[model samples]
Target chain A: MRLNGNRSFSSFSFLALASLLALFLFFVTLLLSVFLYVGPRELASSLLSEEILFSIRLSLITATMATAACLLVAVPAAYALSRFNFRGKGLVDVLLYLPIGMPPVALGAALLIFFGTPMGGIFSARFVFEVPGIILAQFAVISALATKIMKSTFDGIDPEYESVARTLGCSRFQAFYKVALPLAKGGLITAVAISWIRALGEFGATVMLAGATRMKTETLPVAIFLNLETADVVKMSAAVLILAGVGLTALILIHKLGKRWPAV
Target chain B: MIRVENLSMRLGNFALTDVNLRVQRGEHSIILGPIGSGKTTLLKCIAGIYRPDSGRIEMDGEDVTELPPERRNIGYVPQDYRLFPHLTVSENISFGLRVRRSGNLEDRTRAMLDLVGLSDLSRQCIKCLSEGQKQLVALARALAIQPKVLLLDEPFTRLDSTAKVRLRRELRRIHEQTGVTIIHVTHDFEGSLNSRNRVAIMNDGRLVQDLSEIKKYLDEKLGYIPIDLRAGG
Candidate 1:
């Protein structure tokens, strides 16, 4: 009887400690209530609206392009940082992390200032406040995170792989492409997925660099904000749902397709 | 022939100094060193994996000091057998030929497959391979390049006793069949020191130039009384 009394109190304390999880469940369920409040037909029509569709299309296209550009530059940068210890490497590493630490809006402001320079003036005239500006903004902020992920990934792998590959008659570039790149498969997928989501959800940089021009440069996040300005709750909710849905889908696909690459 | 003259390198805190050796063409030499004695550093310098400091490396009587690894054609098998986990055993073996665009790629790969006796497991992914199999794959991959010299760094470290004995025999056979200059590094004395292969002893990043000093050196420092000393002489 005494033992049972002690166990009952411990179990109660354990259940009380789970309060944060219960709170999170309550919030998620409440957020999901938006789909129920609006009729399914109305939600489907809002989803199919031309304006909403354009935002979706633009967001997907620009985010994908940015992620690809980020990958090309980040792969080598990450490998070098992971493997080499050269002069000023410490400074370079710290500088790479600066973006991840700083606010995206600050990065956007710096990019905007750069565009006014003689070198960037012509480029900005052509692309700034345009679709390309959105991509640039997303790439600037997201690549740092991607590079970090990739560097850590490369760090986990041994350097002897490259050394062995080199002695197997592979040139440095061949060794990287054939061995290092293949071994970095799982990390690549994670980097791309995370960068893609980051690009998709980017707002601060895009708003500052591209400006939320309706039907011109507005992404899904911008659309939600724009609808809020006009007090269009339905359209804002629709935009919110779209963003959440896309993120959920991406995560699911990553989870499923990630199996193709053998886990380390 | 492969020759090292005054080879020195500083990889982080560890230093290899004034290491020198010359292995004749078609010679099979084993370098037995204590752990952390820069056996790998010397091998890497030979393979051009790491640039040597204050020294020269020559292969086939040519100063390969300025040559890159690919140009030197030194087949290296690292201790851990860093096989590309994404590739099949077949792809791993044929990687060298594929990189060079060798037209006889299939025949060379098949020969290596048969040589390593891993033909049945050729199609399997590297992640699924055993440690012994990975070691063989690494060896085959290195040899497929038809390198002028083969540098193996503790290739038998992770193998079982039975596997080690079998691989030692296989290494000897391969040495005879290929006639390639070979330098194999190991931390074991009894296993690596054999009569057929010429042996070099290393301690604390330096190789013993005069074998006459080995007994006193071992007895006073390393504390090893070799079996030959116990022959009742």
Candidate 2:
């Protein structure tokens, strides 16, 4: 076993690896124990209840809408950042990253203040503390992440693909849509899934802006928090199960969609 | 006919200075040079991909120096073949005509595939093609629109000896059939250039010679005489 190795890392590497794995299992086991302790009866009955069902439905719809809004803005923004030279390019990048760098509650408060202004008041009356507010808050919290993923995706493609398309008779916009977008299909799926999942579990901004109105604006994450306030552990456990089930199903669905395009 | 008058630009470490040449209609010309020799840069400028800071590119007596690439009906195939991965072979061939909203999409695509002898692989994805097949797909896509001029950068760079022989034969056949003017760039002169084709030699970003003396450059052993070697002590 010691063919010129001199025991350099043989024993220490094994011990260090075991130590790291133990630490990983510590967190995972801690989370799993809660599900087991909550028992199947509590998980099943609470999950099937009307209030939890409404929260789950509202959460899924808002997350889906937020991800769509994120993609609508981020796709072009990321493409421009990847493939063009323009004034204030660096400033635009900084603006995109501001929400990600700050806490979500700060962004929610800032949005609240801006929406309260005279000019923003018209739309604010309809947006603030409503279902629209939930979608807007989730969108704000997740768009930076989506933009970041998409920018990296566009950067990986050779800009020559677009150049070649243009010389092949495609206009600039046509080239982007026909070539770049299709080639980036896999990356776009990942970006959307990440946005959807992040929005699904968003807590701070959702609670601040959407106001957790029972049976109305209450998303799954807000339902969990409200359950905690009332010491309703069974309902909270069911909400966690719903979020986990939704996240896994979304990823699997997107993975299948990504297979349809199958970028080389 | 195609003409370039005083084409010059600076791209990274390379600078092409005051290059001028003319290619007559239906004539096939080859530009020979080593790597980083500004051959691709010159072609890109002519294709309208890179705007040369100073120059004029005229095709069929119309100035296309400032026209966007889409407006210029020139077919260009880069060395790597840049085929759209998501598109099938037939889709790739029809991409050009589809973009231009040209009539007879299916007819033109079938003709191009038949010309390249890829009629059987019409629905195959690009990833499934052999290197030689990919090259043909790139060529077919470019030709679908019936461009007045065609430019190929290193058309036969990375190919097996068998594939190289076949591609050369195919290219020669296509040129004869279409009568389209072509400007092919490559490093191989002995195998790629001939008396029927005009040749230009480039070094360090300058056109050293436009083969005003063709025989002088064709002999591989005699072509590479360093200026200092011929200089007297």
Candidate 3:
């Protein structure tokens, strides 16, 4: 009887621990959501601030460009990781992983220095301190994250599919473009959506590299920071509300697109 | 006819050295060996999946040692079946035909499915098939191309006794009906020796003996199974 009692107590204890952990996570998430809702926009006029409007526009445009460009670069990089064999292959894999762990500010600083240097001076002439600068900064941030995600997505696919395509008489590139790419559609869509959302929310990298100049380099996150400093709580809250709304919409779009992809 | 001359390869810890084999046209040849005997590697080399370090593979009097897998016109059924999991049974069967841009793909797919007795499961996903069903589907997929030489790597291991019997009968029937050359790799002596027209027993990556001396060789290496009279009657 004592032994049975002890066993019951242990099982109950385990269940209780699991319950508490889940409850803790649930409440934490619920609280953040409540803040996201109620902390922003008490009045109507605060929503029309010009800085808020400009930042919103810039954020959307830059994030879109960044996501598109990153995908262009990431697809080939992921394929190389998935299919190729060469010297320094392991080193390339390790290098790709480093960005996911490093601090975003450090990443921003590195980008700033690299781009600001003479070697960077050439490329920065095309991308820095302008509308293109914001896009470029966001591109750098998203590319780092996208490569990691895309690599895993491609790795999950079987090489046999490509081989089968080749045996069917497709060239190597044709096999990848037609067969491997089609099969990796789910992972690719998910990765792009995640990368887009991350680019949209990026503040640390954007602020350091792009420099939050209003009506130019100022993104939504930068606008929020600027308003918060002026203690204009109402305007700051309105901007936050709009940013959160957009982020939520993107998240919903991702879910919807995931469901509807492969229209065939 | 396919001929291999002094094939040698060094792959990590496992190796095949100075191997020679000759498979006649329209013959079912089984390569029997234990695990790690490099049967799969030999099949891969023949199918052009692996580059042998020093060897020549001649197919119909043409040297094809440097040919790529797709260019080899040989069919390979891997141990895992390696079916396209996302494709339906019909699609999987039609894959090679589609790749080859062959005519009447639908007809070929339907015929192969019928032969494998998988016509009922044609529209189902490859992942949803039973192990036996998967093996049949893989076989149908391989046959869709009507490959000149068929290479099967332990094709019967995943099957149950009933499925194994059915598949064996189907294989023998198919061989008879099509007259396609087959190179089967397996460790099962009963199936490899008793079922095949020619059998090669391998050890440590070498074809130690072909069927011409297999019975005598096996008796020397492994003693014969004892006959039981009292239990059977």
Best by DockQ: 2
Off by over 4 Å in 2: A1-31, A116-122, A253-264, B193-195, B208-233
State the interface C-alpha RMSD of candidate 3.
Answer: 3.6
As for model 2, its CA RMSD to the true structure in angstroms is 4.4
For model 3, report DockQ. Answer: 0.33
**How many pairs in model 1 have backbone atoms within 3 A of each other, for residues 3 or more apart or on separate chains, i.e. clashes?**
0
Clashes of each: 0, 0, 0
Model 1 DockQ class = medium
- Evaluated against the true structure, the overall lDDT of model 1 is 0.86
Residue lDDT tens for model 1, A117-164: 999897987667989999999999899999999998889888888877
Provide per-model DockQ scores. 0.72, 0.73, 0.33
lDDT of 3 by residue, A1-264 (tens): 255346565776878778999999996685466456543445366667677778778888889989999999988998898788899999998887776787777777888889888898888766655668677777777786888877877887777667655554556787787678877777788778888888888887788777777777878888888877887766666667677777778789878877855321
Write the candidate numbers in order of decreasing TM-score. 1, 2, 3
User: Candidate 2 lDDT, tens digit per residue, A138-204?
Assistant: 9999999999988988998998899899998888999899999988988899898889999999878
lDDT of each: 0.86, 0.86, 0.79
Would you list the clashing residue pairs of candidate 2? Answer: none
lDDT of 2 at A214: 83
